[model samples]
Target: MKEIKTKIIERIKSHFQDAVERDYDYNRLDFSVKKETIPSILFYLKDEMNFKHLSHITCVDWLEEKEFEVVFILWSYTDRLQVYVRTRIDRDHPVLDNIDMIWRQANTYERELKEMYGINFTGLEAPEEFLLEDWEGPPPMRRDFDTREYAARTYYTRPGREDAQDVRETIIKRTGEELPDFAKKYKR
Candidate 1:
């Protein structure tokens, strides 16, 4: 397994000199590359290497860094290995090339990322809405989107629950036990 990993790492590094090898284990490897090299690297891995399965595509919102990390995970049944191709894009102008032509399932992941993370996948032909329909608020998955604030502003309180005591207070009262100081701050 170690030999296979070393060979794969060498192959990738030799082909893409800028590719940075990141954390890995016995079964997984990660490579960080510039956003522009994503299409070529994925093509090389899928065609040259035996990584034929597109496991999934995910995004991470680095709020403090003002960037978004887009990760493309792939799997190889023959080698029993997984590779994560990671790239970071500017949060203010998140744009990426659509790779649906390489793997058709990429459409679904791209659509979800487009709707949820505001990522514009150039040439991705999909419906405007994937999961969220008629959503007027900011991308809900983003770290800047406040769930509590959105709920309070968008939803109305139930007619009977307005005066309801905090659940913790009720539990403490019924059990005749005092809540710890840390739990008291949650009282509304």
Candidate 2:
């Protein structure tokens, strides 16, 4: 696995002229490429390197960096390897070339990205609302989105909610067993 990943990184570095920043860990190779070069790089990997399966597309809003990181996970059946092709685009104008022609399933992930992150895929058809209906504000997935504030504004909560106690704390006081970190975040 390590040898294959090393070879793939070497091939990309040689062909793409140091266009990618390579990272390997946990048996996966991640290649961070430029937004403009991602489509061609992915096409080459798919056609020549046998990375045929488009596993999924993930988007990360880096509010501090003022950019959005888009990752395309690809799987190779023959090599039994996974490659993550990542690129960063301006958060304000997040647009990229659509790869729906390369992989049909891309539309689903692309549409989700569009709906969640306000990313626009130039060549893809305009996507309808996926999860949010008549959403009028900033993309909820962005870091700047204050979910607690949004919930308070969008939904009607009972009065005196500010004095609510943590449900996990009450449970721990009774049971003498601590709740997991995730459970501790919610209040009664």
Best by lDDT: 1
Candidate 1 lDDT, 90-119, residue by residue in tens:
999999999999999999999999989999
Q: Give lDDT tens digits, candidate 2, residues 5-34.
A: 778888888888736656646668888878
C-alpha displacement of 123 in model 2, angstroms?
Answer: 1.7
Q: How many clashes does each candidate structure show, in the order listed?
A: 0, 0
Q: What local distance difference test score does each model get?
A: 0.92, 0.86
Among the numbered candidates, top TM-score falls to 1
Off by over 4 Å in 1: 158-188
- Residue 37 lDDT, candidate 2, scale 0-100: 89
What's the TM for model 1? 0.85
Clashing pairs in 2: none
TM-score of 2: 0.83
Error of 2 at 130 (Å): 2.4
Clash pairs (backbone) in predicted model 1:
none
